[model samples]
Target: MATPSSPFSFLGDLFNTIGERLQPPDWAVHEIQNRAVLFLNHVLQQEPEAQQRLLRQQGRVVRFQWRFVTMELVATPAGLLDLAPAGSVPELTLTVTDDSPFDIARAALRGDKPAVQIIGDVQLAAEVNWLVDHVRWDVEDDLARVIGDVPAHTLGNAVRRVVGALRQFVGSRTAGKAGGSAVGPAGNAE
Candidate 1:
């Protein structure tokens, strides 16, 4: 797992099942690519460069001579994957990954979400941040709806797993902070 957790069995079992379901089948790679790429292409309509590249691929992949232009919708052993464009992960500039589709969806559903915000001392790039800021979490529902057509229902399950895992993470953090003062800073005081 990319993130670690205590032995408590909050979401581990659920996420494990979701991961299993998310792996594209041996013959389903093409379908998976079509679905994922098309959604991304639609979302990226504002970005002409990426949209052009995506259109050329028929919602699968297109390899241009330049490394920057070639993208592979590869289903490697590490689950469904996409070789995104260089600027795809603009949020990496902050090195914080607290955001997730589930979080965005819940926040927006509750009507307290903002379109954009600054963090620390960094100014997120205007274009990329603008894209992020404009992307509504309802789009997440759209993605999930599209994935519903797939035989495996991978994205749907993954979203559920993510929400469950996040709940577990919050519970763990709360339990640790609320109960650990009695044990002092370290787990033990030799």
Candidate 2:
């Protein structure tokens, strides 16, 4: 007897098909890339060391690719990021190896980095890895600037709890599918 197929597998295929067929307008993609650069700059500004490191690599472009989407960013002299000029060649390219969105999300929720294939400048890639390891956004602090500290703390705690619950649920589901071993938050089998 053949094993039953997953009921939700079709949804993944449907989403992939739709995503491939329906490309966003170039203008919208440009605007979104601009916003992403702004947000990245904002986060970089919070870490002086990150900015200093980036400043050292000024003019070097880094390209990120996932599926059909690609974004290229160049380091500025001021230690901030900006969109690379069209047709600019990247010194380093980082491509996410994972093709499934759900798997990516699951890995993220489990506090794991998705598999990535790195190509090009080793120094640039090392700097980028350092930035990723050191820099983090203080979401609660940002929220507190708009609201009050007490409310922001409470909300942050709630959000953390919800995320923890989601992590647990996803872990359990994955474990059920893969025998009995569960993957922990660190992506190690438990």
Assess every candidate by TM-score. 0.30, 0.89
Any residue pairs clashing in model 1, and if so which? none
Against the true structure, what is every candidate's RMSD?
12.9, 4.7
Off by over 4 Å in 1: 1-13, 20-22, 26-30, 43-105, 111-125, 135-190
- The digit string of per-residue lDDT tens for model 2 on 1-190 reads 6644555567778888999999999999999999999999889989999999999999999999999999999999999999999999999999999888888998999888899999999999999999988999989999999998999999999999999999999877776668876566788755
Q: How close is candidate 1 to the true structure, as a TM-score?
A: 0.30
What shift in Å separates residue 92 of candidate 1 from its native position after superposition?
A: 6.1
TM-score (C-alpha, index-matched) for candidate 2 = 0.89
Cα error, residue 42 of model 1, in Å, equals 3.0
Best by lDDT: 2
